[model samples]
Target: MRRAISVGRDQLMSVGVCFGKFTKSGKFKLHITALDYLAQYAKFKLWIKPNGEMQFLYGNHIAKAHVGRISEDVPEHQGIVIFSMADVPLGFGVTARSTVDIRKLQPTDIVVFHQADVGEYLREQDTLF
Candidate 1:
């Protein structure tokens, strides 16, 4: 059995939702992210049918992505890409395409996404230089 990891509220910053087909299965599905208040922490949840297609309840809202990362240096070109687990782009769903640096994130924000089991892989302090 795999051990459950502890996640800190500091690591969760923003939320993102996406829909796409897994490369191996070629069926549609949804991906959700719960970001930490600092916008530097993230947790991901993926929901898909055995065949890879999303359940009917998802509707035409096929794909989405949200920025949970708060950085003094936001990317000049921000956008979302539909990709496989390998991080290969299947297609483009939406794009922010511009940089917007918001105020530093706080620790009480809550983001809602599809329900899926999330495993904590890394702690926020571990990523610090």
Candidate 2:
């Protein structure tokens, strides 16, 4: 039996539980507790369209065309946060391309913070208990 750790809305993007953490790399995945804490704050994030969002939630690799927007500071290797078009934190990803290169990126190019990969490990954990 594991308790769901609760964090404030202000802390959602910046907070992590025992399950994950955000270091020099971008943010890790949000626990079920904070995934809903969308709105207000926005930084180090990338917004993907519904198609991308579904694959992201389904745990598929992200592509450039799938990304609609991104934070200004997202650099190569930086752990950028993943978000749904609705502003929910979908997961984590590492930038394969820098902000400058993103403008000319191809649809098949990858993006950052792919932890837990869609909703596998996280989803699996919930169903087990």
lDDT of candidate model 2 versus the reference:
0.66
Error of 1 at 21 (Å): 7.1
Tell me the TM-score of each prediction against the true structure: 0.19, 0.62
Tens-place lDDT digits, model 2, residues 4-75: 247556655543334444557786544434333422343578888888777777767788888888888567
lDDT, candidates in the order shown: 0.27, 0.66
After superposition on all C-alphas, the RMSD of every candidate to the true structure, in Å, is: 17.9, 8.5
> Lowest summed lDDT over 10 consecutive residues: which window, candidate 1?
111-120
lDDT of 1 by residue, 1-129 (tens): 022135455875433332322556786443323222212221222222222222213322222233322223334333233223433222222222222322332322211222221221122223221
Clashing pairs in 2: 26-79, 59-117, 59-118, 92-113, 92-114, 93-112, 93-113, 93-114, 94-112, 94-113
Query: Which one wins on lDDT?
Result: 2
For candidate 1, give the lDDT of residue 79.
Answer: 26
**Residue 50 displacement in candidate 1 (angstroms):** 36
Regions of candidate 1 where Cα sits further than 4 Å from its true position: 2-21, 25-30, 33-70, 77-95, 100-129
